[model samples]
Target chain A: MTTFVDIQDVTHVYARAEDGAPAVQNLNLTVREDEFAAIVGPSGCGKSTLMKLATGLQFPREGTVIVGGREVGAPVKLAGMAFQNPTMLPWRTTLDNILLPLEIVEPHRSRLRKHKAEYVAKAECLLAQVGLKGQGHKFPWQLSGGMQQRASLCRALIHEPKLLMLDEPFGALDTFTREELWCVMRDLHAAQKVTIILVTHDLREAAFLADRIFCMSARPGRIVAEREVEFPRPRDLEITYSAPFASLVQELRGHIAQARAAA
Target chain B: MTTKRHLHLAPWIFTLGFFLAWEIICRVLKVSTFVLPAPSTIAQAIWEYRNQLAFHAMHTLWMTLAGFGIAVAFGLLLGMALGASRLINAGTYPLLVGFNSIPKVAVVPILVFWFGVGWVPPVMTAFLISFFPIVVNVATGIATVEPEMEDVLRALGASKRDIVFKVGVPRAMPYFFGSLKVAITLAYVGSVIGEQNASNVGIGNLLTRASAAFEVPLVWAALVVLAVLGVVMYVITALIERSMTGWAQRSDMAAA
Candidate 1:
């Protein structure tokens, strides 16, 4: 498979000392096209910094980041992001919040005024896909935490970006809600076949959603290990309880433990 | 007097009771009309001079509004500039605070000196006094934009202007509205300060005119009208805030 993203020995430093440590040091990672990849590490492992670098939110102090045949000199126009917090604009209704990116990204942004109804329909469909059908009139505060997250997903996917970056989008949810979202994400990934890079701290979550996992070392983080999950498509939540899945999780846990020790 | 049927009327009931107590106290102490007129006396003054009061009140209202309107427009632009640029914000925030700290009333004389004892002094004073809160509030709202939200917008190749208009300005709405309420009230104070000394018109001038002539009941009457005007403007602002920034308030009000 052709490499969709190639990061070469990236390093980044914050100008503000109060922001704490330099985020990344000699970090290198690669993911092929159509790959469902997850990055897992302990807290403060610079996983967030990695996300920033990949998405072009930060220019690397050293090394290069290539995504979809372009250098990440600026934030890529063809990427969508959903963070841990829903971060829904409180002023906008659920549908309007989902429609926000369309009003920003070009081609879509230019055409939005002329094709308002069509875009609205697309947003409604995406919202419905995440189980928020007919709830678009409600504001962010009106929805529960789980419901807000689902809307967040819809907003991220609204423009149909080629690259989807999720930074623990389900981290705030309860176990049941988290599992439900994992299933939703799995189906979404399968259907869209767009490359996804999920940055999470949970190994089990990584195993469930990702086809490949990148384990990171803490404090000025770099990828320490890369492993592939040979799970069949359309895997149910039941698979997480299986012996094979347990062994897989245990294996990733060991890599994470070693990375933590090495740090 | 009962709380059950007319619970909404309790504030009015207490207000009437307060006026009755004041009248009784004035009668019991045999106070002169020049010292402290009773509510009944003020009411009589209001009736006798209704037309003059209305005219002056309108003058004060519009002058305050004109100054306040300028403040709102200028403050928003200045606040946006301060919020969007780290250099500007860092340089000006402390300076603005220091400027705001100088008692606004002190500047009224300077304004009068510059503009020469007319509507300009009050209008300029109101603008000067009222704009700070809006600047601070709008700047704060823009500066504190959530990092994740910025990332989301920036990832889509959004320029600084795009991110600001799409996220920063909309995010700043509640803050902008909050500052408007505070600014409008302060504008009234500024106008009154101007009218008290330099201007020949407005309710503030009327207060000066009546008090100087020792028409105490008329002074009391002007004060009542001023209070009513303040309440009316305040209610209008609160209503605008409710309609515009409902999302910010929904969590608290929803349960009620």
Candidate 2:
């Protein structure tokens, strides 16, 4: 498998002080095309910092962070991101929020005026995928928390980006909604074939959604363990209760506990 | 006519009650009309000069609207510009504060000197007073957007123009309307003061003339006209605000 996202020993330090505490020190990771990977770690472990580096929202102080074989400078137009909060613009409706990327980024930007109806149809389709088909005209505040996150996911995927980065996207959701979103996301990846990098604290979430999980240490986050889930595809919520699933989650939890102690 | 009697005649009940008591006291004490005209005499004066008062009231209304329109335009453009530009914000912020601090009424004489004894002085006075609330409100609104919201746009590679027009403007609408509601009332007061300082045919000028000539009844009538004008402007602004922020209001309604 080809490595689509390659981070070559990246180090990120905040410029304000010399506390000798970097956000991420000598971090290296590569995500292959069509891979579903999760990074889980102790609190304040800079998992989100790694996501930022991968998406080109922030540049590493030293070394190269490349996505799709190109050095990340400004944010990549071909990448999509969803934060823990939906961060939906209150002014726009669900349909407009989903169509935001298309309106802002190219080759969709120039084509938006000419292909508005087609793009609207595309947004509607994505909304339907996330179980918000007819609620496109509703504002973000009108929807529930789970629905807003779903709409935000649609916004991220609207432009058909190659890489999707989720930073604790389901952290704010209820347990049932979170599990349901896991299936929604699983199906999305299955259909889209986009590389997904999820940064989460929930061991169960990592075990359930990701094919592989990378566990990291606190503060200056570094990979402490890597585990692969050989579970079958189209994972239902029922799979989380199986013996193998429980073992994997517990094993990852143990690694996190040790990492926290060491920190 | 019955509804009118019930509604319009309601205020006079108290006024008539006070006057009847006053007339009884004044007749007993023998107080002069120059000091406190009897309610019957004031009513007679208003009935006789109703046409003249209406003409002056129309002039004041036109001046108020003109000044208000200018203030809204100036406030929105200046607010958006200062809100958008950090350098401009830094440079003009102190100046705006200084201008706002100076009692706009103190500048009425200067406005009169510059624009002469016509409608210009009152219009400018009203603009000076009314424009600041709108500018401050709009500037604050534009500045208060959620950082996370802007981040999403930034991460998506949205240009500054796109971010502002698509995001900032819509988000700032509620604040602008909020300010405008307050501003419109100020505009009316400012314009009236402006007209009072120097104008040929307006309620303010008539007020000045009435006071100078000791026509206390006409002065009261002009005050009543001013109050009516202010209420009308306020109602129009409220309607506009309701329409502009319909989405937000609907959300609040739903939450309720």
Task: Please give each candidate's TM-score.
Answer: 0.95, 0.88
Residue pairs with backbone atoms closer than 3 Å in model 2 (clashes): none
Q: Best by lDDT, which number?
A: 1
Summarize candidate 2's per-residue lDDT along A45-82 as a digit string, tens digits: 99878977887778999989989989999877788889
Task: Give the residue spans of candidate 2 off by over 4 A.
Answer: A14-21, B1-47, B251-256
> Which segments of model 1 are wrong by more than 4 Å?
A18-21, B1-7, B253-256
Chain A TM-score from candidate 2 = 0.97
**Native contacts retained by candidate 1:** 0.93
Worst 10 residues of 1 chain A by lDDT: A14-23
TM-score, chain B, predicted structure 1: 0.90
How many residue pairs collide in each prediction?
0, 0
